[model samples]
Target: SMETNKRNYFGISQGLIKFHPKQQYCLTAECIEAAAAVLSKINQSVDPCDNFYRFACDGWIYNNPIPEDMSNYGVYPWLRHNVDLKLKALLEKPISKRQDSEAVQKAKILYASCMNENKIEKADVKPLLSILRHSPFRWPVLESNIGPEGLWSERRFSLVQTLATLRGQYSNSVFIRLYVAADDKVSNRYILKLDQASLSLSSREDYLENTTEAKSYRDTFLQFMVDTAVLLGANASRAESDMKSVLKLEVKIAEIMIPYENRTSEVMYNKMNISELSAMIPQFDWLGYIKKVIDTKLYPELKDIGPSENVIVRVPQYFKDLFRILENERKKSPHFCLNSFRGVFPCGQQESLVSGTFISSKQFYCLLQIHSPLSLV
Candidate 1:
């Protein structure tokens, strides 16, 4: 009887241990769902040892087809799309005095302004024309009616001054892009850096290469520029002729530019003061340009920018070649063909101004608050 009781007690203890929550070999619903998601992306038919990428991603590729508008689709773009949706939701949320930070409130206001299509449609091109009527923004191409014989003086059109105005007030990078960045060597102090401006096409190769695709791209770009000029009230025949000249100039620029593969840090990192740079490329006033750009009403303290200031010229050869091209263009067309070219490809507009600069949404919102209060309306 004692032996029987002991056996029964031992059996009861074993059953209790098997039924315990910690001891049970079962997964939660959340874990099972997560596992299902991971498995769905994997193709069991594809051997991992032979082709790991295919084994892991074949099923996913089969499930997600590339959209008609997209050139390609991938995980990064998917993640980016998700992030954009989240950002849109956040930005669209109603501004609450209790919950919103200053930056958030400002962002909400800016987003709201952007979304108000009715206000935008009513305003039309008046706002843009108002901006263009300003001194530096007065496009020479559009100023045919202003000057004697419908010709603006080349003397008044200072390349350095124009570049400064476009870069500083308008945030346009025409040919040379100038910005303050941490010294590559020092990595502590900031110094002005000069780089080749981006082209309409993706690469210099697109302009210089003699291929079917390159020719197609060049033709398309020329047509686009001509159309833009026509839309902006330029004479169609003159616009076509001028845009062709601009395209040729860009091609020359592409020919001189250092290819991406050859542009090593050691090769491109040529540091010099503004005076030395001026001596090297005497066509443009480096010191005056820098001073004008930095000495803004917003930053009154940055008034003493001088020739002695050091700068990093990333593409020295490109600048040398560019100045030569400018000299040739100046000799060929006294009024500066490029000056007229600006009307066809006007900078300082929302689209052109935003390129080549990296700014977070919050930072951009803050900038809008400081510079153009109307942008936040």
Candidate 2:
């Protein structure tokens, strides 16, 4: 089974899977089933005690799963996370006054290419225009505004390994407490340690399967999910939209996490802010840690911090500082993005998300500052 599973790497994993891959109708149940089985296997192998994201999926892909509207393989969770930050920043301001940020422009261009029918269309669009028309839902905006693209052209991609399989292929993945002194002295003595059981939950990378029909159904499902939530009496506060937002946020962050397939520890170590995360261990640099955890073949693109370079996402200050370092480390790596479903913003941030904000939620989206926890241990 190990030999067979290892041999099935169809080179399909090399790049993102666009829906219209030359063949207009190349989706097959066999392929989706294969993907599902892989996911099921990975889930099964996941230790119930561990953090699902760590073992269930790789760092980059785990952080950036595919979106639901269409089977977009390119737009990832991290980039989307960046997109979300730009959007949230805009939304925080008066709608009429919201202006385009660099990340917003990048998202629009990237999103347009993934979902647009015509290659030449400008992806830049107003938030209201986007919500009313181009939302993951299939409804036309207002009366006669037809969206520029059809949902049929989306793409999907994922990776799954059963518990039985993962146990055999690799050592269990876990998180451990760390202390990095100014001298760069690494001590495994005190505090937490990396363990496989920490990442036990199985993750679903692509929102849904890659079939054309499945894609359409999913678009409609997500559309209704948002629309229904909108019509049901509620206020449009970020708090109410929490449920869908967090779900979307998790997958978005996973896209970035997945690429460092085996670098869970290194990714966690490099992400300086991750250590500061509410429940996370002290003094961990997740982004750098992830870089170190994965083999060179699956190394992540660590960006560099520079005055001229725009930050991809509005990460916590710790992360903002480390982004440049991560970028520098990943300078030579290829860039891949994932597209996720976008719906009418739900009324308020959902409760589920608020509660779990400390989880994967923080990885992509920003925290509401539930409490003013002072920095450091």
Candidate 3:
């Protein structure tokens, strides 16, 4: 059976490449292997002029079948699989030498913690629920008993401070995204850049399109959001109502958002001083927000950041439109819009196990984002 399996490749793979009579080169192992590799993957049955891809790749396809877990497969995937296997072996190895860095050791510990599924299952939602019970993160839809810290405080909420805390502490991005990178125009030095962020749903079409399937997707998405919130101790009626507003807000946002096709390098290069940015978009505190997000401990040299700091504002129009929408929403219902901003419901880790039944497709991917984040769902 083993020999039969090996015989599945092209006949050229079974033999070595013979040298011409006048050739002087030795038949080294590396040379032989390299020659065999090119020959092995050629499908002699197919003509190269017609369906050259199949002619070249047929042997490889027959030899290396796609894995059950993967949606697609290729040579790169096979190479990556090998690299991951090697990395896994390295990470699993115990730290024995003083030469090993602290980061390396910590990575191993994290890998071990992630691998301990029994402990994860036992601990379950307790780890994430504790995070949700705090200020700025408190979901109003949650039952007061389970969410014992009382409801979110509107009086204490500051949009700038909340944005900073969410970014600094949990590494979440909501309306605005702030990150450091080499200036797009001036390719030498790095500078902070502000841009628009993602929404809860994967596709923009789910929010934008008016088709039956699109409407169905939105309904499915909304129902999923409601179900996740209800599962997290929120009343079904309240969750459905609250989530409707949240979804409505997101749809408005989707309408205003600039599509991907328009975001060219030249179009996005709006480099200006932090003072200019504040003057332009007075709704947000530019200096204060950036200062709060930056970790002085890690970036001690960046302690000198101030109003004069030149930063790139990618989507200036979006910010203006966003605040205008928010201003209108606030005028209409003061507490309602602010409350919606803080109504964050993170999907639990073990949704199925927690409810003692499979949670199904409602357990959406991390667009509410990877963990407990301060983004709209």
* TM-scores of the candidates in the order shown: 0.66, 0.20, 0.68
RMSD of each: 12.3, 24.4, 9.7
lDDT (C-alpha) at residue 5 in model 3 = 50
lDDT of 2 by residue, 32-53 (tens): 8877655653443444334556
Per residue, candidate 3 scores C-alpha lDDT tens digits across 100-187 of: 7876676567666656667867986676567666666655666443545746666765777767877787666677888878898678
Cα lDDT tens digits for candidate 1, 103-204: 778768877776666787787655655555554455445454333333456665677767787667555567887877788899988878999886656567
In each prediction, how many residue pairs overlap at the backbone (N, C-alpha, C within less than 3 A)? 0, 100, 0
Cα error, candidate 1, residue 273 (Å): 1.6
Q: To one decimal, what is the Cα RMSD in angstroms of model 2 from the true structure?
A: 24.4
Clashing pairs in 1: none
lDDT of 2 at 323: 36
User: CA lDDT of 52 in candidate 3?
Assistant: 75
